[model samples]
Structures are given as structure tokens and as C-alpha cells.
Target chain A: MNRLQNLFANKKSNLLSIYFTAGYPELNTTLDIAEALEQAGADFLEIGFPYSDPVADGPTIQQSSEKALENGMTLNVLFEQLQQLRERVNIPVLLMGYINPIVQYGIERFCKKAAEVGVDGVIVPDLPIYEYEKLYADTFKQNNLSNIFLVTPNTSEERIRKIDGLSNSFIYLLSSSSITGSTLNVSTSIEDYYKRIKGMELNNPTIIGFGISNNASYTKACEYANGAIVGSAFVKHLAMDDYLKNIPEFINNIRPRS
Target chain B: MKYGVDEHGYYGDFGGAYIPEMLYPNIEALRAQYLKVLNDDDFKAEFDQLLKDYVGRPSPLYHAKRYSEKYGANIFFKREDLNHTGSHKINNAIGQILLAERLGKKRIIAETGAGQHGVATATVCALKGLECVVYMGEIDMARQAPNVARMKMLGATVVPATSGSKTLKDATNEALRDWIGNPEDTHYIIGSAVGPYPYPEMVAKFQSIISFEAKKQLLEQTGSELPQYVLACVGGGSNAIGMFYNFLDDESVKLIAVEAAGKGVETGHSAATTSLGKEGVLHGTRTILMQTEDGQVVEPYSISAGLDYPGIGPQHAHLFKVNRAEYVSATDDEALNAGLLACQLEGIIPAIESAHALAHLEKMAFKPGDNVVICLSGRGDKDLDTYIKHFGY
Candidate 1:
């Protein structure tokens, strides 16, 4: 079992995952941020490699991606920075981005390099299930990388079952049918959708994401799934002064330590 | 091999719905319903009626006498510029608006480069009494001020896309985000033959009336349905695809697509996509796109706002790969000069985008009796500012 499977096997609930853009704010801060997140009790983390067109992201993530790109973050540079990942960060790391860059980098080379760099999984939102299954499934499998699939409120139950079958780590449940950074409303309909997915009792765990901004939302999300992920909110936190020093506080704010 | 999209939404190895899960239901809904609605008797009658009465269809195929004499060929101009909104963009807008109504979508959203598509979408929305929103790049709004004004006058909200080169690509990205946010109520009327599966195929079908009319008219005028050469300028390739649609099966007719080479193809500033691009995904469809070595989309430059896009439609990409059509480019100066030549010779001022195709005539050595047809995709009225500044008029 890989880091992702082992983590999911050991921990059943309240598994907090954090997401941030690599090379954002500065160039050499990628590993630094990862170490800080790991130290601050993030169960797993998704390091976003910037793409010029991030259509699925909201303003906060967009700005961070732009800043990351401006800081000269490329997959080549990202991989070089991640060379020492296993030394300091023990939590499962997933590389998240659009599919074009991965295609440009050569899918085989990218997956092999991700494995070499101690990356556990990947999350490509725009990479459709059809494409992943047909083209890159074997490459990911060969690398022991969990290719995480997202489930939205709009996703059909049949498609969700298909996604669950393909997935080995966990399913990413979008808080709503919206882009990143939206506030989790937890409306009656949303609750029903959550209930429907929960009742399925799929083989994989489900981690709610895309708007678990605070303790209240996080708590509400954990009520329906295994855990919650904070992306745009954490990226927003990273923009604050002395962000590295305050990583622990940020984690505490989401789920205060007993 | 067929030049049409397959059951899987691919035109050869290109084209697919590579959108996020947020857009799956919307795209899937459109995918399932588009063909059924398009072929329905009621939908066909309504679409045909709108094309005839509202959009002024059967836009004439005029034989350009002076252009024929100058270019040493029987040159004809397919007059898409005479459409109601001053461009062929209205055809797709009307078709999509009718489709949106049938699908129960309450609002319409679109992205524009030159604002021709924006104005067209807004015009159709007003006709249907639906809310309209157009995302135009901040720079495009400044360059194409008249079109922006026209969209506003047509009762559409114009939102400026202020990210990543601030051009058509960014506007498209912004429009997509808007669609993701309001998936149920909003129907995105993607202006060009770009975007995911059904969009590229759908836009091409709506605009196919160009070739459909041209073929009938050409046969009547020249006693031959097939022209020796057919030319159109390509950005996201909607107009070019439409112009090439009916004639694609006629293997004898030579198809030529012109792209914008801002300064020159070798120069860093150019939108000559097939010339400089690599195979990749952009705007949700797998196609050729101008990008850096690291896969960042390169900002494409062109004097014509309509052609200032970094990629072409997936059909165009497939056609390029299969060698079914000739892809060429003309620089800004060449297009500008061609625009003037058309004004003086043919008594018609073509849109700068169309002028790119016209400019290529100077480079080709045609036989005296070779019949050539060019798609004059839009009028030059929106480009008067650029024309005046270039000529110092």
C-alpha cells in the first residue's frame, strides 16, 4: 500500500488535508510550506503546480497560480524542489494541476518523476475519467500513485460508482457545484446530496473539499464524510505576513488541538 | 476518412469534453440534447425562420469582377459581412439561443475577442427576452470599443476579463468560470468553433449555412458547385469551418485557411497557431496551441482582435494534421494593405480578420480561369479606428 492507502487505512475520520500553490509568494518556499503544513498536523497535502489557465479555480487560487507562475514555477523546477520531500515531510503529498502541463511534460515521465520525488498521488480536475482510464491509468498504477477523482453535486450516481471503482485512495466531494473558494453552505439539498453519497458505502473514503474554510464548515463537512480539505482558505492564509510562522495557528483555527 | 466529429466527440485525435466535474452535467445535458433538438422539425423550422427573417440569411455570394481581374482568376466573395449583426457570428448565436430556450436555460453567457460574437449573443438574447452576460477582455474592450458599445445597447452586461494577457483566451476562461458557478440557469454561447465536444460541432453546424448557400449560388453563377479554391481566415476557426463544411467532401476543391502573423511567423509576436503551436489542450479541447516550452499558453498578437487567439478549433487541428487543407498566415501589414485593396478594387471594406485570407491572394499564383471563393467573414465597420490609424486618414 502507498502512503495514501495506508493513511486512509489507519485513519477513518477528521483527516485534514491542506492545499497551496507551489512557488507562490516566493520561489524556494515550496518545500518550506510543505514542511510547515506537515508539522502543523495536515494529514495529507496537495501542492498545486501552476497552470496559465486554471478554469476550475476561484479568484484566490487564480491569483496564487498567477503569482506562482510569475515566480517561475514549472514542472521541472517543481520536481527539483521536491527532490528532498521525503526527508522533512512524511505526510502523503498529491500534485494538483490542469492536464496540459502534464501532457507537455510527458505523462510517463511525469508519473515516474512524481514517484521518484515521493509524491503519493495526483489530482487533475480537468482530466476526465474517460481519458484517465483509457490513457494514463496504467502509468499512474505503475507508479503506485492514486489518481484522485472529484465528485460534484452534479455528478450522476452511476458516474460516482464508476469513479469509486477507479479510485484507490479516496473520493473528493466538492462542497457544491462551483469552483474553488466558494463557502460551504450546507443547504438542505446539499445535505441530501451528501447523505446520498454517504449511504452508498463505497469502498473508498470521501474527503469533502472546495469550501471547508473554517471550523464550522469543517465540522459540518466531517459530519458527512471522512474529512475536509482547505484550499483557497489556506492559500489565503499563506498570503498573510509571517505565514510560515502562523501555519500551526491556521491549522488550530480549523481544528483546534485538544 | 470522414472530416466530421465521431461518436466520442473527437475529430480524428483531437476534440473531447475535457472540462472539470463542475461542468459535467451541463456539458452532458447539452451533449445528449443538442442533436435531438437540432434535428427536430419544430426546432428546424424555428431556426430556419430566424435565419431567413431575423438574421437575413442567404447572404449573397457576389462575383467580384474587379478582384477577379486584379488577381487573374474568377474571384467571388461570400458576403457573410451583410448579416444583421455585421458578422457571421449571429448565425451560431441565434441557433444556440433557440437551443438554450428548449433546454430551459434562463440566462445566456458568452465570451468575445472582437465583440462581434458578444454583440451577436446580446442581440439574440434581446430577441428571446433572456438575460445576457458577455465576458470581454479588458484590452479587447478598449480596442473594439464600438462592439462593446453595441453589446451594451443590446442590453447585455459586459464584464471585463482582467487576467492573463487580457484577451479572448482569458475571456473564455472567465466565461467558463461563470458557467461553472451558474451551471443550471446559464447557457454559454461559446463564440467560436472551440471549447469542448458539442460546442465545436454545434457552432460549425450553425455556421454551415455559409457553405450550404455558397455551393447553391456558385453552381448558378459559374455552372459549377465546386470552386477551384476556397479561403477563409481562422482564429478559433468557426467561420473557416463553416466555409469549408459542405465542400469538404468535394476532394477537388482546394481549402486554404489563413492565420494572423502579427509581425511575422518567425517573430515572437504572432498568432500563426498551426505554424508555431504544439499538440495540447486549450479551452477544454485537445488542439494545437501556441505555448512556451514549459506548456504555458503564449500570448498571441494580431492587429485583428478576432484573430488574436493562441489556438484553433479541434476540427481545424485535425484538418491541418491530415493535410486536408492548406494553413497559411499573413502579417498585420499584409492584412491592412489587403483591406485597402479590397476597398479600392471590389468596393467592399472587409473585416481585418477576413483581410488575412484576402492578403494570401498576393502570394498565390492562380490560373486565369481558376474560380476562387473567399469568405468575407465580417464588415470593416468595427475596425474603422484601426484602419484610419494605420492609413493615417
Candidate 2:
């Protein structure tokens, strides 16, 4: 099993995954951030390779992506930085970005390179399931890389089932139908939506993401799923002074260590 | 061999809904209901009525005698500029508004480049008494100030997209994010023929009225339904696809699409997408886009705001790939000069976007009796400041 599968199997509840742009704040800070996240208690992490046009992201992540690209972060540069991933970071790593960069890098070549770098899975939001199944499924399978799929409140039950069938790792559950950075508002309808998904009893574990900011939101999300991921919030924290030194404080603020 | 989109929303290998799961329900709902509503008898009647009475349908197919004399061909202009909003964008806006109404959507959102589509969408929303929001690039709002004012006067909220390049592409991204946030109550009226599934096809069908009318008018005027050639300027290729829709299968008729070459195609400041672009996904559709080798979208340039887009519609990409239609480009100087020539010769001032297509007439070798039709997509009223400044008037 890959790192993602193994992590989900070992950790049953209250898992925390932190996401940050690979080359944000500075060029050579990618591995440094990853090592810090692992040391600070992130169960897994998503390393976002910046795309010029990230439609799914809000202002915080969007600005980070822009900053990352301006710092000259290309897929080749990202890969070269990730060459030390296995040596420095032990937790699961997933490369998240739009599909164009992967397509330009060549899908099979990308999967192989990602696997070689100890990357466990991928999360390309724009890569449709139809195209993935028809074209790139085999390459991902051969590379032993889990292609994570996202399910939103708006996703139909049948489509969610299909995503579940195709998924080997945890399914990403967006807190609400929104871009990243919005606060997770746990209204009656949202609670019902979460309950509805939990009732389905799918094969794969579910990890709530998008708007999982602060302790309260994270705790509420953990009640419904296996874990919750902090993306925009963590990326926002990276903008603070001496962020690398305060990684433990950030992690503790979300889920205090016993 | 077919030029039309397949049931899977593809034209050959291009075009599919490549959006994130956040947009799946909205796109899926549109995909499921667009055709059924479009073909319904009541929907058709209302759409036809709006075209006829509200927006002015069957916009004239004027025989441009002076243009014919200059180009050595029987030149005709499909005067889409005479529509209520001074552009062909109103056609699709009206059609989509009706569809949105039927789908129980109360809010309308759109993205605009030149403000023509924004004006059109705002106009339709006013007619339907629905809430309207338009995302325009910060730079575009400054350049196309009059259109921004017009949209505001029409009771639509104009939000400035302040991200990457601050142009149409950014506006589109902002609109998409808005749609993702408010998926249920809002319907995004994508201005061009570029987006995820159903949008490209739906916009093409609505704007197909251009060719549908032109063909009937051509037969009456020239005693022949088929023209020797048809030309239209392509931004996201909505108007061009519409102008080419009925003639796509007419093998004898040649089709030409013009793109904006800001300085020149080779000068690194151009929106000549098919000329300088590679195959990739942009704005949720698998199409050709100008991009860096590492696959980041490159900013495109054009003097005309409408044509300052980084990519074309998927149908245009397919047509370019298969050589079904010829794609050419005109620089800003050429298009500006052509705009002046049209005003002096034909007594019509064309939008700079349309002037790109008109400018190509100077490069073509046509027979004396060859009948040619050009889609004059919009009026130059919104571009008066640019024209004045360029000419030092």
C-alpha cells in the first residue's frame, strides 16, 4: 500500500493534513516546510505545485500560487526540490495542482517521477474522472500513486459512488460548495449533508477539506469524517514572521498535543 | 468529418467539462436541462419573440457595395452591430436568461472582456428582473469605461477581477469561483463559447441565428444560398462559430476566422491563440491556449479588449486541427486602419474585434464576382476613445 492508504488505515480519526504551496514565501523553502510540518505533527501533507490560473482557489491560496510562480516554480524545479522528499520528510505527500502542468509534463512521466520522489498520491481538481479513467488510470496504477477524488455537497449520490469505486485512498469531502478560504459554516443543511455522506458507508475513508480553519471548525469536521485538512489557513499562517519556527504553535492551536 | 459537438461535448478530441467537483452539480444541471428547454415549444416562442421585439432579430445582411468595389468581390456585412446592445452577445444572453428563468434561478452572473457581453447580460437581467453580477478585469474596466457605466446603469453589480493579467481570463476565473460559491441560486451566463460542456454548444446554438438569417437573406439577394467565403473575428469564437454554423457542412463555401495579433504573432505580444498556442485545458475546456513550456497560462495581448483572450472555443480548436476552416491573424495597426476604412467607405464604424476580420480582406485574392459575407460582430461606439487616441482626433 502507498503512504496515503497506510496512513488512513493506521489513523482512524482526528487526522490532520496541512497543505501549502511548494515554492511560496521563498524558492528553496519547499522541503524545509515539509520537514517542519512532519515534525510539528501533520499526519500527511499536500504540496501544491503552483498553476498560473488556479480557478478552484480563493484569494489566500491564489496569491500564494502567484507568489510561487513568480519565484520560478515550474514542475521541473518542483521535482528537483522534491528529490530530497524521502530523506527529509517521512509522512505521506500528495502533489496537488491543476491538470495542465501534468499534461505538459506528460502524465506517465509525471506519475513515474512523482512515485520516484516518494509522492504517494495526486489531487488534480480539474482532471475529470471520465478522462482519468479512460486515459491515465493505468499510468497511476503502475506507479502505485493514488489519484484522489473530491466530493462536494452538490455531488450527486451516484457520482459519489462512482468516485468511491475508483478511489483507493481517502475521498476529499469539501465542507461546502465553495472555493478554498471560506469559513466552514456548520448550518443545519451542512450538518445534514455531512450526515448524508456518513450514512452512505463508502469503502474509502473521507477527509473533510476546504474552509477547515481554526480548532472549532476542525473539531466539527472530525466528528463527521476520518480527518480534516487545513489548506488556506495553514498557507495564511506561513505569511507570518518566523513561520517555520512557529509551526508547532500553529499545529497546537488546531489540535493541542496531549 | 462532422463539425458539430458530439453528445459527449467534444469536437473531435477537444472540449469536455474539466471543472472541479464544486462546479459539477451546476454544470450537470445545465447539461441535463439545456437541450430540453431549448427545444421546448414555449421556450422557443419566447426566445423568438425576444429576438424579434426586445433585441431586434434578423439583423440586416447589408450588401456593402463600396467594400465589394474595394475587395473585388460581392461583399456583404452581417450587421450584428445593430442589435439592441450594439453586439451579437445579446442573442446568447437572452437565450440563457430564458433558460435560467425556467431552471428557477434568481441570480445571473457573467464575465466580460470588452463589456459588450456584460452589457448584454445586464440588459437581459433587467428585462427579467433578476439580480445580475458581472466580473470585469480591472484593466478592462479602465479601458472600456463606457461599458462599465452602462452595466452599472442597467442595475448590475460590476466586480473588478484584480488577479493575473487583470483581463478577460481573470474575470472568467473570478466568475467561476462565484458560481462555485453560489451554485444553486445563481446561473453563470458565460459570455463566450468557451467554458465547460453545454456552454460552448449552447452559446453556438443561440448565436446560430446569425447564419440562419444570413443564408435566407443571401439566397434572396444573390439568387444563391451559398457564399464563396464567410469571415468572422474569433475571441472565444462564439460569433465566428455562429456565423459558420449553417455553412459548416457546405463544402463549397470556405470559412475564415481572424485573430488579434497585438503587435505581430512573432512579436510575443499577441492574442493569436491558434498560431502560438499548444493543446491544453483552459477555462474548464480542453482547447488551445498560449502558455509557457511549464504549462502556466501566458497573458495574451490585443488592442481590442474583446479579442485579448488567451484561448479560443473548443469548436474552433477542432476546426483548426482538422483544417475545416482557415485561421489567420491581423495586427492592431491593420485592424485599426480597417476600422477607419469601413467608416469612410461603407458609412459604418465596426468594432475593432470585427475590424480584424475586415482587415484580412486586404490580404486575400478574390474573383470579381465571388460573394463574401463578414460577420460585423459589434459597433465601434464603445471603442470611440481608442479610435480617437490612435488617430489623434
Per-residue lDDT of B108 in model 1: 95
Off by over 4 Å in 2: none
Candidate 2 lDDT over B170-279, as tens digits, reads: 99999999999999899999989999998999999999999999999999999999999999999899999999999999989999999999999999999999999999
Question: Ten-residue segment with the worst summed lDDT in candidate 1 chain A?
Answer: A177-186
Top candidate by DockQ: 2
Considering the two chains of model 2, state its CAPRI-style docking category.
high
**Model 2: lDDT of residue B167:** 88
Cα deviation at A67, candidate 2, in Å, is 0.6
- DockQ result, candidate 2: 0.91
Evaluated at residue B122, the lDDT of candidate 1 is: 96
The lDDT for every candidate, in the order shown, is 0.95, 0.95
Residue A154 lDDT, candidate 1, scale 0-100: 86
Instruction: Provide DockQ values for all models, in the order shown.
Output: 0.89, 0.91
